[model samples]
Target chain A: MTTSSTLRPGVGDRSVTDPGPPAPRPRGDGAAALAFLTPSIITFLVFVLAPTVGVLVLSFYNWNLLSDGTFVGLDNFDRLIHDGRLLGVYGSTTYMALAILAVNVVLGLLLAVLLETRMPRWLRGFFRLSYLFPFVVSASAVALIWRFLLNKDLGLVNYLLGLVHVDRIDWLGSSAFAPVSVIIVNSWKTIGFSILVYIAGLQSIPDQLREAAIVDGAGAWTRFWRITFPLLSPTIFFLVVINTINSFQIFAEPRVLTQGGPGDSSRTIVEYLYDRAFGDFDLGYASAIGITFALILVVLTAIQFWFSRRWTFY
Target chain B: MSTATTSMSPRLGRLAARVLTFLVLGIAALAITAPFLWIFRGALSGSDAELYRLPPTFDAGTLTVRNFGRVTEQVPYFRFFLNSIIVSTVVTAAQLITCSTAAYAFARLRFRGKGVLFALVIGSLMIPIQVTIVPLFLVMSKLGLTNTLWALILPGIFSAFGIFLLRQHFLGLPRGLEEAAKIDGAGQFRTFARIILPLSGPSIATLGILCFTYWWNDLLLPLVMISDTDRQTLPVGLVLLAGRFSTGSLGTIAAGITMAIVPVLVVFLAAQRYIVQSIASSGLKL
Candidate 1:
């Protein structure tokens, strides 16, 4: 389809082909284009861009929700540097995010490879859909369902554990297991997406390449590592960037399940930001933390993009 | 190099590979399915006894709709449901109108600053919503939209990701149909409305479904914006219900969760094909 479109002639193509219409002039396109774009630009600028800039400006002030602004440049950043709990929040969020990313990428790749092999087509579709169902459900719903399944006394998980004579673990209550549980639930909800991406990547690899590897007496493991893995790197790179960003922004799951509970065991940075701004009524400080978090994300994303060019095939 | 050895080894390897693949995939399927089964059984369980019983029994007599009734009675289930519907619908409709127009411009029109503007829109995708929340709330408060449905619906109406997705779809559309309409003396808006919009039904449906689901299941924005109980969306309302009914039977809370989840699940099942395609395509883009 793309090939056919590129071959066709149109006003757009003519402009590029002949250079007859000057690029700078409106050429009656400006009004029509502006008419088409105005609503989105207005809403985006007002709702998204304005608030984004406002938050950055708000971060440098000491204005609480009640009082007028007093300049407190760098105080919030200084306080953040000294705050031990903030460090814990950063540690917990990073650890959980990375752990979940590793698990999901490995598991998703495994599933994709298996399903794309000589498996029954129907079974492949069924597994794909079943895995994706949890993802399609709301985060709140997923947390609620899991909370029921993992309840200490009346939960089904503990009940099953009893049958195996294993002790019931406080999945959400214990500091040791709460983050682990969040990671597990998050991976479960999200692994399907990574799997699909891997599937797409797997499908794009030409069949002749795999056949040649097989004809050369390469075993499945060797073929996967030597041939498929390299081809799958672009998908892996995409998943890593998206998953990292999402992990840092984790909010709904912990909010529903733990409330950063049992002594702030699952207090992620975003949740801490929420607590400060809303719970503690420290809007100025929260804005400062949020701005700092955003900057960190931007830098991380920039680094990812820079590094991706080296490793990501496409 | 021996023919007999090569033939026999190939046969044996094929059988072993088949068996191993089945074993691995079966275990993965089981692991993926366990939580779903657990949730369903708990939802169907009659008493808390069945919920905690060893081996997790699913007795026929214990399964009933009593909990479903309790869910409605314990919370303002209908009100929250209506709130979710209204917000999701408004947001989806507004997004379709605003995003399609912007997407059309990016896809079809030649204008000054097009490259810069398009880049700005795409760059917004990397900006986390958390960064914008503080001042967004301030804006909402100043507009007197706090504690109202507008706070939830308005902000979501112009998502950058939505515009990007639609623009990609529109750019791939055939130009012949639109050219035919233009030759008939149709203006750009008419050409879009008559030709491009109809041809883009599948993409439109995908966008609508995604936007609806996101708003329907959203918890964070509603949590921050809404202070009034009556205006709370379903997720927020359910959380409040769980807190209030903390001392009550677990059945009611489970039922409320189920109630909140079922309608969306039904919608998804009905639109499973389009929804799945959207996820697959969008997954690749990400």
Candidate 2:
């Protein structure tokens, strides 16, 4: 009966009644498919595939804008291991990315869970919009606005600090505060996105389950631990993976805010790579860094995917 | 009696939950709004307003249009705005056409090498643009496309994410509808135009909003691609203004920042539902 119902549309009465008939191929299906896929294929090849292959090839040879190529086999990779500034840059980038991810996920989840409760509809919407406002603004604008707010002598942050009798600190100029400032700004910009994702995940959970838990006398904390928290793992897992990838690639904020330092304090890997290629005109080394960064990202993402299998409910 | 006792605790718990929820939301709201208020205050302050001075004041009487005037005169503000609008609009339009057609093929068609080709498309997502910058720049320079808006617009149009997103949306659609149209003697092209295109409004809006916002606010591409001052996008343009005003006073820079973000913010406000929905459904899977 099930087979008959499933076959009714495609095969009609004859095929449904007779258990052994060959399936018919639609006419022009191949031609039609190729015609539709042509644009995407061409675009993928030109922009993504070609450029990727180019980067891999460029990594093996020493070719700047002016000079002809010299195949310097593993030398670039070798230098990457020992370069002092490059090492510092990697440390700063990883530290900053992880910091931002931690803050954003924790705060975002908290906010999402809060907003999902009995808040007024209009109020919830307003808060969501406000949270996401920083994201919608351009990165340069965010940098400039925050710079104004954080100015040591003349900025509002210090002024506010004065009211509380706190000594003014150079938020952007100090090495210690500069990375923190970047992380704060990035978190402010990105937490909204994480919050929105969490809300969606939160909404997907059936209220009946919570109600049942309550009827069985499960307290708020208990209900959350046993029910809500586990359900939210998938969303959390997704955010962590994407956020980590994005963090490793951080550039604009540090560039605009501190130019990567009160020294080399805030130099991220991408900034380091940029300097090597454009600042010093060392393409081979830059390509090597790029390759390394890509490999790290792949490995990290794979681990996340593996861990997700255990924790991600879906 | 026991049932009554149990109900009493649950009711109180509900009340507590409500109150706690409000408190958390209020704090989140403040965190989000604080920066915006700071920006607003900075933009409106007079030139002489001392930085780091306690009790920040924005006396409406002291506010002036001086910063706006300075932003316009000192930099090519209008030109940057024009460049951003033109680049973003062109990229969005081109992506719409390219992504939709491609998505349709992936969803409905069965061609040779389709599996391998589709894998390539999805795999490209893992390759960040940073890795490809050198080669892309080299190619652009060779083509004499550097410093031109085409450099930004062309690359922005062909996104793997866009293709993947539209394909997901297309796959969710009922195949029976398209099949019925096909049975009516409609050719592939005809069915696509008369059937598929019209049904794709929601997905298109999602892609359009995402693409527009991305290109509208992009910084890295413009920074590297365009060296000429007039060719800079809004982000680059604002950075230049910031550099010009980075000397003690920030009034002009604050005003420039405000102006730069307002249009995109307004678009975000209007289309927020679509934005939120798209972001949610896409699952930040990228």
Candidate 3:
């Protein structure tokens, strides 16, 4: 991966595109290279590659840890398309992904810009630490802390609402509110990441460009749109794809907090996959779900990559 | 961007802008830090009543160390702590060793199949462990290693991101030093161990801290592989504790959470620069 990006622009490099002259291999480089690469290669092959292939292959069979798996060609995919539960699963997963992505990208950008310009120099590091502490802690801890905070009664959030004479709400138990609550907690945990990225992006925008725009009498918002936003598009695109990939695998939050409660209102696809695979012992169907999930990621990522070119300056 | 206000606006305007900036930052910081504060107080409070009390505060009158005792007694807290330490340490060590060696080969050596192999390493980044959990579970059961620390540690030992990071670092090193070492009767391994690895401190620290944070907080893999109570990690153990004390013991649960987060927080503070550097650098990479 590193080499391709470096090698792509080269015109006629013999080192690449030609794996020729293999009659009598030089023993010197080959032996040392083998020695260095053996451990990680073997580890990756067995743990990663084999399992990736296993996911694809297992999707074609009907197996439950007991009897030998019977091959059922394309039937799992057929079930995947028609599975009614999956409709809700995919819906919830997409909702969470888009919700979290919006918060991480937009809210994160706003916070980064606010801190970049508005925050006092003496307090910048302290504020960054405050924002990032949540991200540093375990996800389970975050979920459980919010679970406590969102409890029906005797919860800080509800108590705060009671201060204004508003009735207490079941933040995690209600179908209407669970999704919103989960998204908020997940966002709270992860938005720090986007803040950091956007801060870096904001700083990387050379002052001269903005200064030139200001010399032409551009206002704050106008200068941001004309001079800053375009240059920050690459960072924005990266955050969108990365956060989407992350949020698509949202399991621990809902699993710990709500357990897909209120009639699967907060169920994510990975939790659904866990249920089919482990809870139901339907490995074949679960593998099918995994394959479908991976495909969704691939498509989402591909769309992002394709769309990036239109707006990404680089 | 204080320069924005200072460059154009009047002194009073600049003062107002500065106040506004601090106001926004202070509010955001409070929101972000509220959970930590609540958990901290709950961890140190006398009882669940104190924990659930509105206007939660750290009053010397109500504070006690009893919850800390309950945390240890209620669950195998120390055992869980030990398991987390051992797993994270072994995984971190393995990651550093395997990733650096593979990275050195990819960065410097000229050999057949290096390009394809390097691509394979980088490509694995997109393939998350969740996708392969089922087959991986099967692998564990086949080896009869279920509920063992090895089951949790083995699959996590080598990551594509680690290899990619070290390789990037190695590529940035000046070739002169290595060439001089090579001419001065140093072997490839010697040059890598002495010349290359010594100067790659920042990259190594970044990757090491990254791996430590990852293995320390890892939940899904362990949740799937380890079913035994004594074998469970801190995150899983805390989840079990939460389920057990759902109706009571908020103080103890808060203590458990505090215990769980302390090591990670300490790690973050100690290696604060590298951890943030890791995140920032990876942002650029992506």
lDDT of 1 by residue, A71-119 (tens): 8988887888898788788888888888888977888898888787676
Predicted structure with the largest lDDT when compared to the true one: 3
Worst 10 residues of 3 chain A by lDDT: A6-15
Task: Tell me what TM-score chain A of model 1 achieves.
Answer: 0.87
Q: What fraction of the real A-B contacts shows up in model 3?
A: 0.52
Computed on C-alpha atoms, the DockQ of candidate 2 is: 0.38
Candidate topping DockQ: 1
After superposition, which runs of candidate 3 have C-alpha atoms over 4 Å from their true positions? A1-28, A118-122, A211-218, B1-16
lDDT of 2 by residue, A8-62 (tens): 3432332333344333445445655655665556666766777778788888898
TM-score-better candidate, 1 vs 3:
3
Regarding lDDT, does 1 or 3 come out ahead?
Answer: 3
List ranges where model 2 is wrong by over 4 Å.
A1-28, A161-167, B1-20, B50-53, B284-286
| Order of models, best lDDT first | 3, 1, 2
Q: What is the TM-score of each candidate against the true structure?
A: 0.89, 0.90, 0.90
- Per-residue lDDT, model 3, residue A185, is 93
Looking at candidate 3, what is the lDDT of residue B266? 82
Clashes of each: 0, 4, 1
